[model samples]
Target chain A: MITIALPKGALLSDSIELFKRLGLDFTAFLDSKNRQLQITDPTNTAKGLLVRATDVPVYVEYGQAQLGIVGYDLLLEKTPDVAHLADLNFGGCRMSVAVPKTSPYQTPTELPPNGKVASKFVNCAKTYFQQLDLPVEIIPLYGSVELGPITGMSEAIVDLVSTGRTLKENGLVEVDTLFQSTARLIAHPLSYRLNLDNLNDLGEQIKNSVSKS
Target chain B: MITIALPKGALLSDSIELFKRLGLDFTAFLDSKNRQLQITDPTNTAKGLLVRATDVPVYVEYGQAQLGIVGYDLLLEKTPDVAHLADLNFGGCRMSVAVPKTSPYQTPTELPPNGKVASKFVNCAKTYFQQLDLPVEIIPLYGSVELGPITGMSEAIVDLVSTGRTLKENGLVEVDTLFQSTARLIAHPLSYRLNLDNLNDLGEQIKNSVSKS
Candidate 1:
């Protein structure tokens, strides 16, 4: 059986729809009252493991699940050893360096040296600043990163921006965008190589579903 | 005015009640519909910034918040430069090493060498394994760490255990507990040293509240 690791959150509905197009139904996760993390389709062709978005890649990398659906940002941040099969293209967002609207710095490079910047994506933020050769402290915060600048704890922050509403509501402005992220189809390397349980064929069918969408 | 950073979610109500006993109120955060991240008590003697539990110290260390409340586990993991003032004694939990109930290893050292052990507290888990002279790969996962063993991605997982309901549901058992954790009061080092805004007095009041409770 080909078990799939599906992320639990905003992108869940889109991910379920995509799999539905591939003749596998795992939409039980969309139910508000559904607490089950693991479910199997009526056809028994596939099993879905509802998990945190960040853990999707980890599950696939370790061969627990032959396939996974995850955000590109997580792929970049986690850098798991998974086969990047196709771009599912639903969860569109960008990672950017943002500062309070009233700040003097307009761009990331314009910010002062040795300043503190907070983000949940520490590695991604660190790499971006390192590429610019700007040495700054990247404080790790798992949530409400916008609070960093508003509270004066951090001069800037690097975080994922989706609707841009959160930033505007918090009185912060994007200084520079590091990358755009979207949902992608990922597979375990060994599973893909061995083509176990028709894994390769199922991968192609999912790719076709993406193209059709 | 003294700016206080209170953690959001389960700890917020208790934190606010503790502060209430100390003569400062921040219960606005407990309102279900409140979207405001920052609020001031009617007396205006203090301001409260609602933030993630992990970021509590970051705000305190930067002096954006002269005082903060966070879980002891966070203080242990982040090790921010803040004055550990008092323990509020709520939000009790423990950091533990768990494995699938079917696993043969009964102790951390008995687990397979070089096996993956996932946890959000990377530093703590690393230290625990290192002390046992057991070299294992510590995979950092921010949420739902119990899935690590269920999916066979990890032979073991080191995570926070409150009632162990999640682990029990996931067919995992606690092998060893690293330490018990509770809510703690912390302050910016400089603020504590200078006794600004009657910081020392406020600290005493909070300690008193804890003792009285």
Candidate 2:
């Protein structure tokens, strides 16, 4: 049996739709009343686990799910040992360094030495700043990265920005973008290599689905 | 003016109720239709910021909030430099190490050396294991830690166990508990030390509220 891990928020519907096109039905997740995190498709050939976007890689890395649909940003932040199967290409977003609009410093480098930068993606933020040779403290905030700047907890924040609505509403402006993110189909390395449960075939169908879409 | 950081989920209502008893009201948060993250008490003497439970310390530590209500577990995990003031005596839970029912290990020490232990509270788990002189890899998971054992991702999971319903339903059992957690009233170090915003007076009122309740 093949199991797939699907992210719960912005990428869920598109992920379900893509899987539906591949002949696996797990749309029960879209129902507002449905609270089940794990569900098996009607055919029983596959099952899906709805989890946080950040957990997709963990599930796939441990072979709990032979495959997972996750954002590329998480792939960067976590760098879990999973096969980068293919890009399914929906749920586009970007990770960027943002600061309060009123701040005098414009770019990451302009921020003061040893200043604090907050993010949920700590590793991603750390790497970005390190590459720039900026020695700043990366405070890991699990929620509301905007609060980092709004509350003066940090000089700036590195966060996922989509539509720029949340950032603008919070009076934060993007100073530098690290990368663009899109939905990605990832597989467990051993499962893909061993062709366990015909994952290679399902993986190929998913790749085809992306191309067709 | 004083700002208080109140947690957003299960503890929110209780935190507000406690504050109400102390003569400060931020009850707008309890309204089902309310969408605001930040609200001011009608009396205009204090403001409240509704944020993730883990973020309360960040707000208070940065002095954005003179006070905060948060779980004791977070204090152990984040170890943010904040003054531990009072325990409000509500929002009770426990930090525990849980394992799958079928797992061979019956206790933390029984688990194989260097086994991967998954937790959102990686620090707590690591500390507990280290104190036991057990060297294990602590994998940080952001959601539904029960999946750690169910998926064979880790030997066991250290997570918050409330009623233990989630763990029981997932076929896991708690092998040990790190500590019981209750919502604690914490203050910014400088704010509490300097009695800024008459924090000492407000602090005594909060302490009285808890005792009176």
Candidate 3:
């Protein structure tokens, strides 16, 4: 049997739908009343573990879940050891550098040297700034990255922007996008190489579903 | 006017009540209809910034907030350079090492060497194991730590246990406690030293309130 780790937030539904295409159903997680974190599909051919998006890759990397669905942004940040199986192409968003609308800085590079940039994605923020040869301090704020600028603790913030509503509501303007993100299917390396539980065939089927969509 | 950073979760109401003793009311944060993250107390003498518990020290350490209320657990984990003022004594909990109830390992040291211990408090976990001269891998999981044992990803989990309800419900038992945690009053070092906005007086009043209770 193959175990798949599904992230619990924004990408959950689409991830479930994609898995449903393979005739494995783990929709029980979508029910708000359900408190179970791990569920086995009715067919019993697969099991699903509902976890935080950041943790999906950890489970796959550790071989706790032979397969996992996670965001490309997490892949970039964590850089966990997992096989990149397919780009599921759903849950699209972009990682962007944003600053208070009133700030004079118009782009990421324009922010002053040694300025603080807050984000939950600290690694991504650090890498982006390093690529630009900008020496900005990345303040790791796990929640409310928008508050970084609002509280004047940071000159800018690096965060994922989906609909841009959050940025707009927070009075932040995207200065530069680091990368566009989409849901990705990742597999345990050894599992993929050995074709454990017909993993290769299932991956191909999911890839086909994504192309059709 | 002084800015006070208040944590948004379990410690919020108690923190607000403590501040009420100082005649600065931030109760607006408790109203279900309130969507504001930052609000001026009706007295206008101070402002409150509602933020994640982990970010409280970040705000205080950066001097974005002259003072903040946060859990000692976070203080220990983040080890941010903020002046530790008073132990509010409310919002009490404990950081414990928990494992599956059915597992044979009864104590932290009994667990096999190199066993994976999952926790959001990675630093605390590492410190505890290191002091014991036990080699263990700490897997950082930001959410749903109970799922660590359930998913068989880790041999144990280090987490904050309040009523022990979550651990009991998840079929886990606490084998060892690292430390007892309570909400603490903290301030930016410079702010505390310079007595900015009568910070020393406010800290004294808060300490008095805590002792009186």
Candidate 4:
């Protein structure tokens, strides 16, 4: 049976709706109160595994699940080995560089040499700065990176900006954008090769729904 | 007045207790329904700012709060610049390397050259592997990294192991201990330098509580 890993939070509802259009009844497994990790569909053609959104790719890449739905922010940061089947078009946002409103660093290049930048996405921030040949000390933060500049710990941050409300409330402004992010359909390379017929059908149905939307 | 950043979840109760011993009344802010960001103490000697455990350091480091209480696991993973003032000896855990029980790799050195290691603490994993000169791809996962090796996505994972129950349930075995972790008292360098007198007193009281415990 084909197995799909679905992110357990915000994306779960939309993912379930998408699968329903594919004629897959995965609603029982998608129920928020269901603590059961793995649930089989009544039709027995497929199964669903609920997991953290950031973990969807890991599950797919390892072939634990034939397919997965995850955010682009995670994909950009982790760069998992799974094949990008299609963009699901939900959970959209932008990964951007933000700085305190009072800071003089308006552009990426204007950032000082060897200055500190705090972000939960340390590797992502490092790669961004490396492209500019700028030496930076990446201070890894799990959340609330806006406080980096406010508390004088770092000069800027590279994080997901959903509505600009978080930045605005924290007295920060976007300095540069790295990428536009949206949820995408991903599959294990081996799974795609092993279950080509079934996976292809599933992919087509997802694409059809996305196009319709 | 001095300000303190306390974790909003499990640690909140303990933090309130500690502050009460310090002659500060912060119990009312512990209500989970309280939407107020900052709550003032009755005597106004200090104010409490409730935030995520992962965000505690960000608040303290940015000088938004002079001191913070956070788990050592988060501190090791984040490696923020804030001073490690005192070890609170709570929220104890160990960051360790783990792999699927079926894998033959027994030690860190046994990992195949250029193998993949997954972790939410990407920086921590990178530094650990680099110190041993191991050439492995560090896959950054947000959570549930234990599932990586189980599903064959990665060879191993570096994550916090509290009771080892989670690992055992997933058919994973501990391979190596990385670091011992506990909750800690952290201070912004500038805050410590400027408010040495008051900060030191508060630090002393907290230290006394830790020693007694």
Query: Which regions of candidate 1 are displaced past 4 Å?
Result: none
lDDT of 2 by residue, B63-151 (tens): 88999999999999889999999999999999999999999999999989969998999889988999999999997888888878776
Give the per-residue lDDT digits (tens) of candidate 4, residues B20-129: 87788889877768756577899978888777788888778767788888888778777778989898877778899998888889898899997999898888898899
Model 2 docking grade: medium
In candidate 2, residue B11 scores what lDDT? 96
Candidate 2 residues lying further than 4 Å off, grouped into runs, are B101-104, B114-116
On a 0 to 100 scale, what is the lDDT of residue A40 in model 3?
A: 92
Question: How should the candidates be ordered by lDDT, best one leading?
Answer: 3, 2, 1, 4
Clashing pairs in 2: none
Q: What C-alpha lDDT do the candidate models reach, one value each?
A: 0.90, 0.91, 0.94, 0.83
- Give the C-alpha miss distance for residue B2 in model 2, angstroms: 2.0
Docking class of 4: acceptable
Best by TM-score: 3
In Å, residue B196's CA in model 3 sits off its true spot by 0.9
User: What TM value does chain A in model 1 reach?
Assistant: 0.98
Angstrom error of the Cα, residue B102, model 3: value is 1.5
lDDT agreement of model 3 with the native: 0.94
Candidate 3, CAPRI quality class derived from DockQ: high
